[model samples]
Target: MVLVSAVRDYISRMLQDISGMKVLILDSHTVSIVSVAYSQSELLQKEVFLVELVDSISKSRESMSHLKAVYFLAPTSENIQYLRRHLVAPRFGEYHLFFSNILKDTQIHILADSDEHEVVQQLQEFYADFVASDPYHFTLNMPSNHIYMLPAVVDHSNLQRFSDRVVDGIAAVFLALKRRPVIRYQRTSDIAKRIAQETAVSTVVYSK
Candidate 1:
C-alpha cells in the first residue's frame, strides 16, 4: 500500500517472471521511475547484464540475440516509434515490453504491424509511472513546477506540457494503486482547478 513498495513490487513482478540473462531497457522518464525504487545492483542480481536507453539501444548495429530484452518505458509516441524500429529489426532472442502507462489501441496496432519477425514475447501495461520519493509521497519531478504559478498565457505550450504531465502522473498513481481518488484542490487557484479538471478526465481515460 505504500508508494515505494508498490513501485518496487511492480518492478519485481516485471523482472521475476522472465528468466535468464536480460538487458533492461528504459526511456528517459522510466529511468527515474526505476532508479527511485530499484537499484543497479538489484538489477544485476536479477540477471540483468545491461541497461540501455530506448533511443540509444536502437542505434547499435550489434545484435544481442543471446540476451532477452526487458523493456521498461513510458508509453509515449516517440518511445513506441523507437520500439517499432527495434521490432522491425530484432536483435534480441525475445522481447518483453512493459509500459509505464496504458497503451492506446492504435499504438498496439502500430506495434503489431512493425513486429514482422514477431520476437515480442509479451506486451503489457504495468503502470509504475510515477517517481516515488518515499512511502507516503511521490512526484512527477517536473523542473517547470514553477509554471503553475504563472498564467497559462505566459508560456502556453510549457504550461500545457506541465498540466499533461500532472494529469498523467496523477492518473498513473491511481492506476498503479488500483484506487479511485476523491480529489479536492484549492478552488481559488486557476492552476489547481485546471489540474483537478484534467486529472478527472485523464483518470477516467486511463482507468478503463
Candidate 2:
C-alpha cells in the first residue's frame, strides 16, 4: 500500500472504535501526516471538531472535556514532553496516543507517570512515518538536511538532526511494509553514508 494509505488506515482505525465528538491533536510533524491523508472536511465528518497542535493546545486553560482527544504524533522527545505536561492537568476527557513508530519504553513510562488524571485511554505505535509526497518519490524533509554535505565534526548538531529524521522515515517505511530488504546508499554522499549507518543500526534494533 501507499504511504498515504498506510497513514490513513492507521488514523481510520484509531477513530473507528470511538463514536463521539473528538479533537485531533498533532505535533508539527504529525500535522503533515494527517493533512496529507485526511482533510479538514473529513475530520469534521468524523466529528473531529478541532485540530490543534500539541504545543498550541496547551496554551489555553479551557477544558474541552466534552471532546475525546486522539493524538497522532511522531515519537519524539518534544512530543513526549508535551504529553507529560498535558497529562498533569488534562483538558480533554479521554486521550488516545498513537505514535508514528516504535516508542521507547521509557517514553511510555514517562507518559504513564504523568497521567495522574487518568485521562489517557490507550497508547500505540502506528508506522506511517514518511510524508507521502508522491507515489514514486518521497522526500524525508529533514530539517538542516543540507548538513549531510558536511563532515561530522564540521556540522555535528545539524548532521545529527538530519540523520535522525532520515533514519526515522526509512524505518517507518520498512516497519509499515513488514519487510527486511537489503538497502543501498549513494557512495559519494557524506550524509548518505552517515544515514545509512544510522539506518543499519535502527534496522538491527527494530528487526530483533
Candidate 3:
C-alpha cells in the first residue's frame, strides 16, 4: 500500500492544518490522483464540503466566503492561467495552493502577481503527481502513448516532454517515501533508459 498510503498522507497533511468547512479544487489530472486514493466519505470526515475542477469552479459567479478553497493541481500553464483568472476575482475567502509536483519560481511569481486581493493563505508543493491505482502500481496517465513507440530522434521535443513527465512521476513517488533510489531500466528500450536518466536528474535536483 505504498502509493496509496503516500497519497493519503499527502492529502491528510494538506487538509489537517486547515480547519473549518472547505472546498477541494482539483485539476483534471489531479482528480484522478485523488479519486483513486480517497473517497467522498473520507473527505466529508475531513470537512470538505465541495469538490470542483479548477476550470469548472470559475464558471460560478456566486461568492462563498464562508468556505476556504484547497487547490491541488498540476503545475501546467493552463492550470496556472485558470488560477490567475480565479485570483483576479476570487469567490472564496482564503486559498491554499498545493501543486502535485515541483513548481517553478515563475509559476509562483505568476500566482503571487495575480493575487492582488491577498486571498492566498499558503503555497506548497505536495508531490502526488501519479495516480496510485493499487498498492504496488501507479500511473501518470500520460497522453502521448504513441510517442513511446517512436525513436527519440524522431521528435526530440515531444520525447523530452514525455520523458520529463515520467521522471516527475517517479520523483514524486520517491519524494513521498523520502528516499533516494538507484534507478535501473531495461536495456532494450531507449525510452526507458531516457526516462531513468531524466528521473536520476530530477532526483538530484530534488535532493538539493
Candidate 4:
C-alpha cells in the first residue's frame, strides 16, 4: 500500500469513529507522520482543536473537561509515561488511545493501573510507525539519523534505542541528511564513501 494514503486513512478512521471536540495528542515521530499527510486545517475539520506533544502536555495542569482526548502516539516508554500522567489526573471528558504500532502487555498493564478514573473509552493499534511524505516517499523521521554512520556499531545501537526503532529491507535511509557529512568534513570517512555509493545507487535506480 502507498504509505501516505495508508497513514492518512488510518488517521481519518480514528477521528471519525468518535464524535465531539477532540484534542489530538502525538509524539515526536507521529507529528511528522500526521503533518506530512494531514494539514492543520484538515485536523480542524475533524474536530481536533488542540495538537499537543506527549512530553509537553505534562507541564500544564489546566483542565479541559469539555474536550475529548484522542491520543495518537507511538508505543514507546517515554510516551507511555506521559499518557499515564494524563490518565491519573483525568483532564478531558474521555480518552481514546490509539497507538501507531503494537503495544506490549506490560505497557497496557501500566496504563490500566494509572487509569483510576476510568476515563479511557477505547484503546487500539494502528500500525503506521513511519512518516509518509508522499505517495512515493516516506521516512523514519529520526532527527539524529547521522549517528548511523558512526564507525562503531555502538553508536548506531544507541540511536536505535533512543528512538526505540528498527529497520529492515531498507538502505541509504538509514543514513539521512547525507550531504551533512560531506559538507561538514574536509576528509571522507569510510561511511562517507558508502554515502556516495548509496547516492549513486539511488540515482541509477530512479533513472530506470
lDDT top scorer: 3
The regions of model 2 sitting more than 4 angstroms off are: 151-153, 188-190
Model 4 is weakest, by summed lDDT over 10 consecutive residues, at 168-177
Model 3, 1-208: lDDT tens digits are 9889999999999999999999999998999999998999999999999999999988898999999999999999899999999999999999999999988899999999999999999999987999999988988897757757665556678777777888899998888888888988888888888888888888878978
**Candidate 2, residue 58: how far the Cα is off, in Å:** 0.8
The reply for model 3, stretches above 4 Å from the true place, is 143-146, 152-154
Query: What order do you get sorting by lDDT, best first?
Result: 3, 1, 2, 4
Supply candidate 2's per-residue lDDT for 122: 91
RMSD of 3: 1.7
Query: Which residue pairs clash in candidate 4?
Result: none
On the 0 to 100 scale, the lDDT of residue 72 in model 2 is 91
Error of 1 at 200 (Å): 3.0
Better of 3 and 4 by lDDT: 3
Global CA lDDT computed for model 4: 0.74
Give the alpha-carbon lDDT of every model.
0.87, 0.82, 0.90, 0.74
lDDT string, candidate 4, 1-208, tens digits: 4666777888998899889999998888788889988999999999999999888888989899999999998888998899898998988999999987667899999999999999999998765777766776777766766766666645555744633353311222223212222223225566555445544554344233
TM-score of 1: 0.92
